[model samples]
Every structure is written in structure tokens, then in C-alpha cells.
Target: MTSKPEKVRWGILGPGNIAKAFAGGVAHSRTGTLVAVGARNPGKAGLTEAFPGARILDGYEALLGDPDVDAIYISTPHPSHAEWAIKAAEAGKHVLCEKPLGLTAFEADAMIHAARKAGTFLGEAFMYRLHPQTARLVELIRAGAIGEIKMIKSSFGFAMPGFMPEHRLYAKDLAGGGILDVGGYPVSMARLIAGAAAGKPFAEPDEVVGAAHLGQSGVDEWASALLHFPGGIVAEVSCSISLAQDNVLRILGNKGRIEVADFWYAGGQQGGTGEIRIIRPGDTEVVEVKEDGWLYAFEVDAAGEAILGGKQEFAWPGMGWADSLGNLRVLDKWRAAIGLEYDIEKPAKRVNTISGRKLRAGGTAIPKRSIPGLPRPASCLALGFEDFRTFSSGAILLDAYFEAGGNLFDTAFVYGSGYTETLLGQWLKNRGVREQSVVIGKGAHSPLCYPDVIGKQLTQSLERLQTDHIDVYFMHRDNPDVPVDEFVDAMDREVKAGRIRGPFGGSNWTMERMDEAIAYAERTGKQKPGALSNNFSLAEMLEPIWAGCVTSSSDEWKAWLTARQMPNFAWSSQGRGFFTDRAGRDRRDNEELVRVWYSDKNFGRRDRAIELAKRLGKSPIHVALAYVLAQPFPSVPLIGPRSLDELEDSLQALDISLSPDDLAWLDSGSDQARARA
Candidate 1:
């Protein structure tokens, strides 16, 4: 006799209306069992009653932390799916999240990243795709049952008689809309059919044009879209919340058409029969599909089997990471065309009550420079506080900087694993100086360099910085794989929404890439990058200190900046401690300094700087920083200081100014050349 397979114990993240259906499905699934139900409000109407045999947990996090729960089914609202799916993946549980997996492709990418990082399974719960009829339809289409497929038409919608604005169906904060709720069905079906015709698991639409009727609550009520797929295939998909639709799917071909009524129930609704009709010239055929259980049970069983088989996602139904992300990309574009936006996705202006240590208007003021497109003048020196580990520790140096009239703070998402931003937020909130401070938010670092991550990371950064708008946002790294226009459009959306004020640009992008991005923005009538951040110092870099790093102090780069008059925020502006006496010429003693900035050419420049510093009675490091500030174009150098003393030492560099002749001599140590200039 064969041994029975072990059942997968499941946990439900939310106990709501749709979760009840998932509970029913789980109960009927052969390889799945409902072990726990997590309810935010345990006293709610449907917790114990909907899931009788399952343990009632107090919160979603509690359920995820439970050891007995091997898998989690995320049945929360669309906006909450990404967060909890990521949490579940981090907790090492297989995840089955509801459709419209995320509000945007960025969220989907983040969730996918989490799952892949944790080595866990994560599948979107498009239960209808697991139905037998969907499989048969794909098989027949590939077998030429529908010869030369050309078009697909699908829709799903329902009429709510008494639509409440506060209901999840109409609340923008809850990510409620016809497109995110029911429109995913039509879009997914259309993509699946197109993929079938092309002999692939799934295919993304090439072009999408969408229009919507938004309700008073600002949520889409009725939306329609036309998608152009590969091989000249077109699909007309529609969805509605206040109006009823046919709720059917049809694929038209040159030889025949396949029609599916109530396609979302293709596995047989509650143990009933599903029918697909084939119509050709002068002939008609009916195909009946039978099921042994509920329609949703198939997805539950499939998820469990994939987990048992050590698969990250379902194979036959094709609810993998790529499919989920591609579907979200199409939806994101469609929503963009229709102008349907959720308020929850917007950056909120945080208002915190101040308690201690009030800020004064005027003090030891730092020199300010005006960058194009920025409403306010920025301090020429920005403080890099990524290394501060605690609020108390960061607050002292921050207080000293602010009191000294330094306002700009540079922080990135990858900094201190987000602790740096949180500390900055706390300090700003405590001091009530958010309005006066200039926060430079950097995001989309290497390996996470997708265009969608720009918005997602910016949102998180804003929340952590205790402000709605970043004065100057920078992409921390460049991703050559993605087109420059896509990056431009992503930043444009953030700018239009008021999340970023102006002067957004790239941190380490080459001049050519920056020009390409600016041209694309100008051609598309979008905002162009107004600033750049690159390495610039008196001591030249022999190689990149880190991967994908670029320097703006090269002769060619400096000339370009001078001609364009662009602002370049110079990072490592003092040569990463290369100008100090602690760095020696011996490559074996200081390998990092030698590997990065120790070429014969750089050593010669350092010698020139040392001589110039001796003549001017200043530190060589001070001369290095002063050299950066005295450039032909706008140059703001970033300084990372660990304490008040370090900050004061850095501020001393502001006192030393370099003349054009002095800069020329420092570059080549040629006194005759300085005279010629």
C-alpha cells in the first residue's frame, strides 16, 4: 500500500468575507488543512463562526510567528497584501496571496524579492486559473481547436445597490476599485489566452488603453481597457463595481470561437458542472468540465503540492513571480491611463508635536547655493548621518549641525538597514524642524534597481523621514538593464504627486546616461534630473571604491558640469580620508586606499595638495574639500561626521577658499601653467 501524503497546515491572515470562501476551500482541499485564523479584531462578527475548528489568533503577526502554521493564505485587502506576504515569507511560510497581488508592480517585485530571499513559495491566489476548464481551454487552443486566435473579450462585474463610500469597494485608502478587485480577472484571462495562442505560460500585453468612470469617493466604479498582445492579438476587457457585466470570457479565432460563461467558476461552482461552448461555421460543440470539490479548492491543493514538491510557485496554472509581476505591470499602466489613484499610496505630511530643544531662525549659518527647480536654497555642505546608530547619538551632532545653520541631511534606504532614516525622523519630529530641513532621499540601490522600487522605497523613506516631500531625491545606483525613460516616468509620477519637490537626479550615473534620461524627460514633457551626485575631490580615484560608482572630478566630467551649470552633490568629497597623514604611500599597509586612490597620478596630485596646504597654512584635507567647493559649477560636498568634533573639523574646510590659479596648480603642480592661465 502507498503511504498518504502529509497535509499542509494553513493559516489565514485575515478573517473577512472572502476569507470565508478560502476557509471552505481549505476544508475541502485534499492536501491542505485550516490550522489558524488571524483576526485583527478578535471580537469581530465572523472569526469563530467562519472558522470553527481553527485556532483564533489576535493579530496577523501572531499567526505568522506560530510554529504549527506551515503556510499562510493572505486574504486581506489589496493594499495590505504586499506587507503581510513579505512578512510571511520572512517567517519562512509558503504564501498564497489574493489577486491583484499588489497595488503596483513595485510592491509585487518587493514581495517576490522577499520570497526568493527566504527560499519560500509565494503564489498569487488566482484560484480560477487552477480550474480544469482553464487547463482544457489552453490545451485545446494550443492543439489548434481555435485556429489562428485573434481576439479575446472578457469582463467581470457586479452592481452594488447601496454602495457605501466607506466600504472597501469604494475606499481609496483600502485600495478599493473595480480594476483592482474584479478587473484582474478579465486581464488575467486575456493574458492567459494570449499566452496559450503563443504557446507560453503567460504573455504581457504590448499596449493598453483604458478609461474609467470614477465614483464620488474617487474609486473606479466602471473601467474598460483594450490590450494589444503579441501576434496581432487584441483583447477588450471590462470591469465594474456599480454596474453589472456579463461576467463571461470569449476567445475569437479565424476558424472558431470558444465561449466560457461564469469563467471564474470554471472548476464547477460548489461541485457543479462548468461548460465551454465552441462555435464554428454551421456547427456548434459543448464541452462539460466536472469537479469533485469547490472551485477554490484546486488552488489550495496545488499550492500545497508545490510546497511539498519543493517548488517556489505553481507550474501548470502559472502563478509564478514573473506572471504576477507582468499582470501587475499591465494593471499599473491601465490605472495610470485611467487616472485612478488611491490616497493611501500618496505621501502624507506628518505633523508631530514638539517638546524640547526648539530651533532658532538664525545662527552660525552655512553657505547656501541655489539649484535649478528647487524652491529653497540648500546648504553647500550636507551631513551624512548613515552611521549614527541611536537617536541620542545622532541628535547631538544633528543639533550642532542645525544650530550651525546646516539643514540638508543625506540618507538612503539601504543605510543602516533603515535605522538611519528612522533616527533622522525622530530627531526632526522632536525638534519640529521638518519644514526647515532639506531631506535628500536616496533609493533603488544596486540589485534592487527596478523602476518600480523607486516609488515604493520613496514612500517608505518619507514615512521614516517624517516628511512628505524630499527636496532632492536621488537614485542611489544606476541600472543599465532598464530603459532611461522608465526611470524618468517613475520619478515623474512622484514629482506630480508632490512627494518630491524638485531637483531629482542620479547618484552615480554616467554623463551619457544622465543626458539620455534628461532627453527622454524633455521629449515626454516630464521633469528632468536637475542634480547629480558623484565622487569629486582633490585626490583622484584610481578605481571605483564600490561597484557602479562614478566620479565627477575628472577633467572631462568637470568640463561637462561647467558647461551645463548643473549641481553635482559630491560624495566622499575629501577623498574618503585619503588626504590625511594616516594614509601612507605603501600599498601593503593601506590596501583599500591604495586599491581605490593610489595611482602614481593620484599620488602626484596629493603631493601638490600637500604643498598647497603648507603654503596656505591649512590641512590637506581642508584644501581637498575647498577644492571641491571652488569648482566652476554648483558643487555641494557631503561630509560624514561621527561626533561634534568631527563636524566642527569638517566645517573648518568652509573657511579655506581656493583660487582658480591655486586650483590649477593643485591639479598639475605646474607654476608656469598657472601663469599661462
Candidate 2:
């Protein structure tokens, strides 16, 4: 006996024009049905008329909370797609968001992460790809109908005669541009065709060169890009909002060429013959393909099947997570080349009004420690600004940290793609405490870890931090391939130029590398590295936390730092929650903690910490932090607190102190009194 197909109930978020097409597609699909339509103004003209059979909801959140809705079709504007898609996933509903998936690749990453965490399906809605004609095109290319594919040319453009500045296509704040809007189509099609040549689902371009014509509204009216993919495949793609183009996709190979006119509209609204033309030396042939339903219906059916199959992403002709990410990454590079930035894309300043409590700078009297070169003292702990997603949410925790005596903010160029720095900068400017705070800026992370990126990223970081100079600058990562002297010289340039005033150092750098850098700086009469940021705590890391990460908690590393009297900014100094009761040998389910910190030796250290905490009337976690602070060399631990309560709990660690004998006993798991003797 055969089982009946599972019925997937769909909800439409932001009942806009595209949403009507999606709802119509779902109505035509066998496995999917539209049950609800949500809009901020549900009573607006044409909304109810468009989705007559579906329940009209008042807001997008209402659709997410609807139990009968199994999945949501997010047709919101580009800027709002990421937020609503994440919320829908968190609410246990699968999502099919409109493209481009988000305003930036960073935003897309966040959406993918949320869906994966929720174990829900997420697919970007590029309706053309799912159409039968696209599949036929891919099959023909893979079959070598066009032998040894070498070049691809695709364009999507239309003329907006009376362009409105506030319209999404022209509004920079809404991430409106030809590149992010229509440009994605040509890019996706090019990548898809290139992937077919390589026998893979998709392939990313190795190089991209883009040019754009920015209109009066500060958004791209027309843009073009040259993309170089692997396997000697090259493509030239273009899109425009104010200029009309052929809107065709042409793939040229050594032996032949194939062209598809009105590629994006094929098998969709036209309701006509879908044609692919092949041109060879002797003859030109036309292949006509027929479609059964709207182009959007294919993606609807595909998403429903994936959800029923318990897959987190859609398969071929459908967008997987990596495919979405790869496409967005290409767009990011293209935008960078053309220098396109959106106001809504920037981090907004948020006011913290938790319980109507106003933020006052100094409330808890946090202890400050002196650094080598800076005249101002930094807080013993640095506030890590990576976890909070929104500026207001982060501001609440930032306010609490400041009230508790935190003047040092830890941020990096890679942190939320500079969103963290933007948030901290807005908070500093809003609080009018830029001079009072110590900003620890970091740059030159992986993939961009070069001599030029060191200076360029630092300049962007400084601008984001809203400060004239960074108090302490750190290379976020190290590349051993580059000469140590070159890295030193790049940093020395910044120091001499007054962009960095207090100290400069390396994070995740080994002791040997640090010595090499410092010695080279000394020999060249340049500024030496004054601090080192690495993992150091009671629980030893079984492996590097991330690529190129280093741990300084080993006995040899500790001895080196002590001998040199070098300041160490210890990250994950509290053992990354290892000292808490939540961690244990039997708790193998917490894979990250278990894989990083679970060991026989670390368990013994935890036991000793518990004993010390009992004697001092403090928590074991607090005692673990105190041990790092009580080290022989200058130690400042970075704290990442997700909430106000967690921040307050971390602050209590400042009051706990450990003597030399106590530290030795904790490390050696021996009696303190005997160790002192």
C-alpha cells in the first residue's frame, strides 16, 4: 500500500506583490497549500483580494506563532528578510525567503545558523532555478552539448521610467541596488551553469571585478561584473534598473554555443514555449520545453518535499545553505569593488531601557589596572561584544558592564563583519564616554591576513569604533607564511602615525612567533609587541579552539610570559564554562565543551577549584577567573556575557583573589600549606 503525500501548510509573511505569486504557486502545488497571509496592514487594498482564501493575519509574528502553519514564505523587503526568517525558524517553521537572501553575507550567515540550530529547512527563493527549463539547461551543459564550456554571458535589466527614490529598488537604506536586486539573477544563473560544467551542485568564482553606475539616489542603477571560476570558466554578468538589456543567458564553449532568451521569465509568467537554441559549425537547432505550472510552484513543491524528507536544505535546482552563502559572498565582493554601502546595513544606536533603568557610567566601582604604554588604566576585564545580535540588546549588557567598571571594549574586524565595532562605537558616542573608555581593536583575521590588510583593516576598524585612535591594537590572527618582520613593520607604521597609541600585540600567536616579532621590532627601532592574547585557564584546550588559535596555559608558555614580564590578555580564561557544574566527564552530549576541555587532568583541576571556592565562599567559576588574574604577569581576561545577569555574575570574580601558594596548590592539586613550606 502507498502512503498519502504529506500536506504542508504555508504562511505568507509580508503580503507584497511577490507573495501573491508565491501563494498562487502554492495553490497550484500538490503537496503545499497556503493557509495564512500576514501583513502589517492586512486591510490594505488588494491584500485580501489577492489572497482571498487564506486567513489574513495582522502582523508577521502572528503567522510565525500560527500552529497550523508548517512553513513560511518570507516576501519581505531585503533588509527585513534576515530578521523574520530567523524568527520563523526559531518558531519551528521552515522558511522560503526571497532573494537575495539578506542585505549582506553576514546577515545570510546568521539566518542559516538559526535554521540549523532549529533543525528546520531554509531555502532562498530563486524561482527561475526550480523551473523545468533551468534543469534542462543544466542537463544539456553537463552532457557537453556545448563542449568544454569556457565563457558565460547573462544579463537582467529593465527601464524604470519614473523611478521613485523611496522605492526599494532605489533606496540605499533598504539595500536597494541593481546588484543585490536584479544582479543576483545573472550571478546565480552564471554560477549554476558553471557548476554544471564542473559536475557539482554549484561553484564559486575565484575572482570578481565589478563596475557600477551609481544614480542620484546613491544606489546602483546599472552594474556589470567579470567573474573567473574554477576549471577555466569565465562569465560576464550585468543587471540594471534604469536601462533595458537583452535579458538573455548565453553560454559559449569551444565547440558550440547555447542561448536562452528571457531566461528568468522562461517557463514562468509568459505561459509560452520555453526555448533553448544551440549553435554549432554546421547547423543551429532549437529545443522547446513545456512547463506544467508557474515557475514558483517548482520551488514550493521542492521545499515541501525537503521538509517531509527531514532535510535542512533543498537539493539541485533548489538552494542549499552553502549555495546561498556562496552567492552572497560573490555579491559582497562585488559590492566592495563598487563601494556600495547601505545605511540600514550599518549598526544602529540602541537605547537601553531595561525596566526603565537609565544607564549611569560609574556605579559599581570596577577595578582598573595599568598598562605599559597607555596613561589611562583599562578595566581588568574586557567586554566581548560578539554575542548580542541587536544594538539595543547589546546595549543593555554594555550598560551593565560599564556600571560595573568596564571601560575596555573588545571587538574585531571579523566580528559580525564590523557590526560589533559599529555597536560599540554607537554606544560610546551615545554615552559621551569615548575618552573614558579603552578600545581594544583587532584586525587582519584569516583570508585577509596580509601586510596591506593590516593597515587597511585597522583604518576601517578605527572608523567603526568612532575613535581617533585604538588604545590597544591586536592582529586577530597570524600567518606563519608571512615574514615576522613585515608584520612588525606594518604595525609600527600605525603606531608612528598615532592611529594606535597604547599597545600593539598578536592574538592566537605562539610565544616563539611573539618573540620573533618583538625582536625584529627592537632591531628595526620599531614599537615592540606589548601584550599577547591567547587561551589560558584552568581547563586546558585539547586542540586549537579555531584555526591558528594558541593556548598559553601550558607550563612552558606560562614560564615564558613570566620571564619576560609581558602582559597577557587571556581569552576564555574562565575555562569556557568548564569550572561550572554544568560541565562533567559524563556530559559527553555537550560536544564543544567535552571535546575542548574534558580530560582527566582538567577534571582534577575542577575538583581543586571547587575546594578553593568552598574555602573562599565563592563559586568555582569565580575562583577559576581569579587564578588567571593572580598570575605573575599582567593578566586581563575577556568576558562574553549574553545577558545582564551573566555580566553581574562575571563581575563578582573581580573581588576574589588567590595567593601564590593557593595558585600553586590549585595548579598542582596539592595542599597549599605544604606548597608554601
Candidate 3:
């Protein structure tokens, strides 16, 4: 591991024109020093004369590992930004990469996640934002220089006199496009203005729509986008490589307008006059922002100070983590609107994690347990990933889970309207971990609950999941109105037909019905329910969490599960945030938490869990999850984590071992006297 430095010793990854400009800024920086320049080949020529003191490394990898370097500035083309940024973070080097942060928001998210996992700094290099001029502009707008802001108009475009296919600006293979290149400037500024109007660091567009003309190379040449923000503020942003635009920023309000020419560059690298013009109906006011600081030096020092200050991100005026993510998301939408997709965004190219490394063997292995009829043991903790909308988003998380020794995924026919299943399938195929993984697919949910609909929905689910057989299939909801015989026979037919090749069960089913189905199955020689998926948490459910939910936390139900020894693929295993501090009695904001896991008995259990957690040096939520894992029978708590932090937090339970007495006290407080001993 690299030691922290008082002054950030910076390394330039790609010594191109942008890197040279930034090096000039570093020469003027207060808290930063240029230490090394890394190139593709072993050349001591171009960058050395520019900076006589800096060493020239043979390759980017060498620079990343250089003991003298404290941080890295990635000035490579747009395509490699995410990859190198992630690699730098993995090497424990702070990263400041040129924008856009990634070709798409998904890549941006992965880069951010990688830095977080590595405990390093990662920032998008938008030097304009770190300049004092931007702060003043925001301050002026906040002071109502333009009262009741209504519209924003900004453009950053330049005409390439000759559109050579090999040029970085026009090359399709390089992810060349107006939206992904120069367009981020106008969009980011618009968001900053919109955020100043509303009271935040930055705001994402509520709606984005755009149109662009694709060149012969299948990349967007020029594009225009309209962003609708909150409070009826609209922003018109445009960019191009082959079209000459005014390169101006205009913020119009109800009473006046603020205008700036070439706002991004401010004055020049050396700084001259950055004038902000306010034009009212009858008068014109000019605010001159003048400083001798180099334009890029401000960003270099900003990153240096943040790193030395032990901050993972830059302050407001500069793009924070969320701010960069929001900007990239808008760019993604704009590119999507214009049908601009880079070759890298395709599934064929996105098979690996953004960090290009597996997350397994990270010192903690997710404990695995065997399920009936599976070829191999699966993780005790199952992941329900229904929130991701894109393949990259889902793949990143899935990759983390799979590499962490988690081989069970909970998916459904109705998740994301089948898009979730499609993404999971893509991840399974991409990762080639299908046979090693257990997929719990649920279908025939409420409103569509029928014996006959199961097969049809299962077929569609199989197709979406790109698998012919589901390892662990379940009926999402039970229909008592439909005879248990029909349900059992239908499931048996499917089992015989090999649609469900592993454990088959029912989710949200009553214990009485499950027993009845098992009896019927045994009597008729059909497949009996192998597992159950119900709400089984430390806190008992008082009311339904959702429309049709069942809780197996009752004493009788626990006794039944213990006696039968059936593995329950429990949902909402963390009590749906019940054990968390957010579930206090006074915090009734979450009606669902109040409705389902909000009784005096459950609160008493929560208190006991908290008390035990304090003794165990863990959180009440961790104790709650540990209680589930220590059940008398097989209990695989289905955990849903949207990000790496949440996933790591959930994994903390794997280290907590709750004995039978501890579990008894957590469940009923009967063994508390012995537990404390």
C-alpha cells in the first residue's frame, strides 16, 4: 500500500496535449507536484523537457505502481477513462480523470464503486468547476442576480475543418460523439445553474429529450437536448464536432438574463477577463472575474487539498461523486435520445466488471450451504437484484456477488417487467456462472394466480432468463380458491417436463396450505414443495408488508419449519428495515415499516436484538440477520443490496455466530438471563 503524502505527487497517465496543459497547471499548483509522466512506450523525449524534474515511466501500469506517485491524472481518450481510473484506484492512487467520467453513466457508476471499494479518491477532471469564477456565478445566481430562473441555454461546439475518420473527435471506435465529448460541459453547467436555483450541489433532469445527426461513422456529429428540471426550469444544451456554435452560456430568469462567452475556459490558462453580463430590461451590469491563476491549476490544487485533507471527493464548486454521476446520467440520456451507442457499450465488449478484477477472496467468503436437489452448495445469503435497469448496472453488482462466493440469485417474472430477468440472463451468460449458480424464479403472482398460468409464465421467464430450466422455482403467491391438488399436479407436470430441475416451492404460502399440498403431492406421487419463501425475520410481522405477504415468524410456523427441516428462501430477511434505527416508534414516515413490523412485541424483540448486538459489537440489524442464519432449519435470507456499501454491510452478518440460546433470547427473550452469562 502507498503511504499518504503531505503534497500529492501527481502522475500523468497519457502525456497527450491535455496532459501537457494540466502539467502547466501543476507547475502553478500550490499543493500538487508533477512527479512522473507515463507513455505507451519507453521514450524519454517529449514530456521530460517540459518538466525537467519528472521521471518518464515506460507504461501506465509502471506509473500506477511508482512509489513516488501519490495521485494520477488520466488524460487518455474517453474510452479508457473508466478502465484506467478504476485501475488507479485499485492501486491505491487517487484519480482525477478527464471528462466525461465515462462514455455512459453505468461506467461512471462502476468507476465510483471501484474507488469506494479500494478506499481511494476518484474525481472527474472538470477544471472549470474548481475555478473561482464558477463559485461567483453560483453565488450571483443564489443572490437572485437572475430572479426566478426560467430557462438555460448553453453550447460548446467546434467545426473540425477536416472530418478525418481517424481523428479522436470523429472516430467511432474511440467512443467519439458530441454528447460524450464536449457536450458534458453545457449539460454540467446547466445542472449547476439548475441546482443553484433549487438549493443543492447539483440536480438531475426530471426529463431529457434530444435529437442529433449521426455521421457516416455512426457517431453523433452534433446534438441538441432539452432538460426539464424541477420548478419548470428548462435548459437547452447543444454540442457538435463538425458544427461551429457560439460557445456561450445564457441563464434567463423572469426579470433578467446572465450571459458569458466561453464560460468553461474562463479567461485563458493564464487567466485574463471572465466577465459575467447581467442584462435587465433597462440596464446592463457586468461582473469581471479576474485572477492570475492558471485555469487547470485550480483543479490540480483542489484535488491535492482534498486528498491531503483525507477527503474522497472534492467540495461543491467542483464535481463531487454524486454530481459527476448525475452529469454522466444526463449525457447517457442525451446519447440514448440520439441513438448514439459506442461499440464498448455493447454486450460483447462488457463481459467483465468495470474494475476488470473479480471481487471474490476479498478476505471474507460468503458462507455457503446446501439446498436439496442442487448440483452444488449455494450461499446462505441470496441476492434479490430487481432495481437495476441496464445490463452493466446489474452485471457490476452480480459480478460482486458471484465473486464473493454468492451463487444464488432471486429473480421473478414480474421484476422490472421482465427486464430484470433479461439482465440477469445476460450476466449469467457473460460470467458463465449459471451452472454454478442457483436461480430462484417465481411466477403466477397475485391477479395472475392460476395453476395453468404457471407454465406459460415460466416459459416466458425461461426465455427472458435465457435458461430452459429454473434451479429453484416457486409460485409467487398462493391461491386457496384454486384447489391445492391443481397447483401440486401442475407443478409436478412441470417438474416431470424438466422446466423446474431443482427445488420447487411456494412463496407467501400459509403453513396449513403448504402441509396440505405436501400431503396431496405424496398421496398422488407428484412433486412436493421443497422450500418456502415467506417473511421470516427476527421481528414478527403484524400486518402485511405488501398486498399479499406471509410471515413465518410465528411460534407455530417456526416449530413447523424446524420439524420439517425445509429451507425457506426468506424475503425481506432484514425485516424490511425494521431492525434499523429508522424504525423507531416516532419515525412513522415509512408507513410500510409501521404497518408490517411495528407491534409492541416486535419492538421488544428489536430492543433485545439491539442489546445483544451491543454485546457482540455489531448492529441490531446484523444481530437480526444472524438470528435468521442461526435458525433451527435451513434459512437462506434473501438480501437486496443496491450498492457495494450495502452489500458489505449485509455480509457483516456472516461473521456473527448466534448460538441456539442466543437465537432463543432474540426470538422470545426467554433465554436472556442465560444469554447474558
Highest lDDT: which candidate?
Answer: 3
Best by TM-score: 3
Q: The CA-based lDDT of model 1 is what?
A: 0.84
TM-scores of all models?
0.58, 0.66, 0.93
Clashes found in each candidate (C-alpha, N, C closer than 3 A): 0, 0, 0
Off by over 4 Å in 1: 1-5, 349-677
Task: Please identify model 3 stretches exceeding 4 Å from their true place.
Answer: 1-6, 44-53, 336-340, 358-364, 671-674
- Tell me how far the alpha carbon of residue 292 in candidate 2 is from the true structure, in angstroms, after superposition: 1.5
Query: Model 2: which residue pairs collide?
Result: none
- Of the candidates numbered 1 and 3, which has the greater TM-score value? 3
lDDT of 3: 0.87
Query: Over the stretch 129-180, how does candidate 3's per-residue lDDT look in tens digits?
Result: 9998999999988999879899999999999987789888888778997888
Model 1 shows how many backbone clashes?
0
